[model samples]
Target: MATTHHTNETPTDVASNGTAPTSTVSPETLLDYYRQMVEVRLFEEAATRGFRQGKVGGYLHVYIGQEALARGFLDAFRKGDKTITAYRDHAHVLFQGGDPKATMAELYGKGTGLVKGKGGSMHLFDVENGMWGGYGIVGAHIPLGVGMAYSEAYRETGNIIQLYLGDGAIHNGYFHESANLAGLWGKDGMCPCLFIIENNQYGMGTSVERATANTNLGSKFDSYAIPWEKVDAMDLEAVIAVAHKAVDYVRETGKPYAVEAMTYRLGPHGAADFLEQYRSKDEVREARKRDPIGLLEQRLLDLGVTDEEAMEKIRAHAKELADEAVKFAEESPEPDLSELTTDVYAPETGLI
Candidate 1:
């Protein structure tokens, strides 16, 4: 069953209350999650280098500290499940089974890119893989995600939408309107949309505390009568425990649910954000202690699932994969001149 909170429950309630059951994932699964995290870390680090060297263009929002949220939640994703998120979305697509080379090529604006180089870093689309393109606009995709979920509900597809958004978007008009419709449709057990709020503390340079009067993004869902809770996204186990329940609940009941993943953006908002004047260095330093990859490593060590040698090997392999992706992106060809007229709209049809 989907874990539920009392009426108007704040994010702090679940963060302190242990509303989600403790994770009982096997050691083997934990190790796999750790491997994925390592791969993501290496991939993001490479992306940062690419952005700095001018190989990657447009805004580069690497998911450094916030890997576990996507890593853990997506572990529970079914084959037909759909994911939509904001611009900080490379991790989402990667975790959703997207090809690393194609994703990097997209960032490089190569013709071999995921969306044929039409969409840059902020617009990756792999519909065949269920990643429905990341939006460059804040709150812009909320209505679209909701509409998609409603479509599934109407068609009885037995599928759901993993609609991800940042804390900043919760205050936007689109969020409120779409959430209202989700709640209304959910009353009939129809809209199976799992709202995963990736609250990484900051929406660009503005901190969540400064951006909203009510800092508990989860509680905002209460207004629409949607069951919501918060999880410490820094721990993979904690995230898995909650995400499994939430995904199962949404799938079984065909209703909307929300999980506010409390996480931090370890890196600057984007690669171009060289001088993060808003936050202190000490804060970022402290947040590093809770790095999901580090935390997962510690747990793996505790359980004797892996040791230093294995971890080192994993790191090396991940780095090699990242390097290969970079090379592919660099060598890939740019969009052809004829591409300008293609993919502008659906192909015309004749009914005669």
Candidate 2:
């Protein structure tokens, strides 16, 4: 088995060892990453509070500790790129230019939501932003992502698809089927998809060790002849570096690739998963030491990108945005009864 390791080195340190940092990514981009990460963290924290207060119903899965993984990849997104992911998707939508007010209103089941309050937390969608939908069913979106890539290729659009899935979804037959087809389709240069496996070590209560005979999640793509790699999710720079390379490879070669990000969920699987019976507090505590937001904050300071005061100001601004989102949701009206039958089917003219 390949050994998993952790690192505290900044991106510059890693590059200085031999590989130089890419010249294209500027200091402004790095600062923006830090700001976005802070915004996501604050947003999720507010969502958790809202869930506790009964503002949000159904299952609530906040992207707390896994901010860096999404931020890293989405930062590298281009005009023709599309993205899809699982239910833990609030951050994904927000980072991709989805309206925070509408997202929060969706959580509150208000008519002003992105999906008109019908989709709620798990089904956020924004076609304009190229965010398809966040699937509630485990592994269901895998096939959909591949299908989207195929459609893009068929249309000769040269667009890339970014498909995100959790560690647990890999065990599903849907994932395997999609991978097999992605491999076949890539042979014709028809599938430019980057399958990102957000391996947070557990699929709900079960750890990867308990769930799989072979725990190297990235290597699972080997069966389909797809290239794969693993990266430390705690480090934004590391993730950004790898993400740029992966996206470039898919864009240039028109093939599928996989990246297993070794990350951890600092919160319960959902708002109701209070017991957390599967893991110990010590394990959670240890993981907190490598908190992605904190890691990035320190890196920014070390790199002289910003000072402590400026960082704190960013944190305050993020919190203000999150607070305003909640207020927007609170003020937004609930979906009217007439809305029940409005979006049930397409118009007679044709499916729009």
Q: Which candidate comes out best when scored by TM-score?
A: 1
The CA lDDT at 46 in model 2 is: 89
lDDT of 2 by residue, 1-352 (tens): 0011111122222233446334244566677777887887888888889999998999899888998898877755776789999999988888888888899899989999989999999999988887888899999999999999998888988788999999999999999999999999999998999999999998999999999999999999999999998889888877877777778778777899999999999999998899999999999999999999888888778778999999989899989988999999999999998888776677674433
Question: What lDDT would candidate 1 get against the real structure?
Answer: 0.86
Give each model a TM-score.
0.93, 0.92
Measured over all alpha carbons after superposition, the RMSD of each candidate to the real structure, in angstroms, is 5.9, 5.9
So what's the TM-score on candidate 2? 0.92
Displacement of the residue 107 alpha carbon in candidate 2, Å:
0.3
Question: Where does candidate 2 stray beyond 4 Å?
Answer: 1-24, 349-352
Residue-pair clashes per candidate:
0, 0
TM accuracy, model 1: 0.93
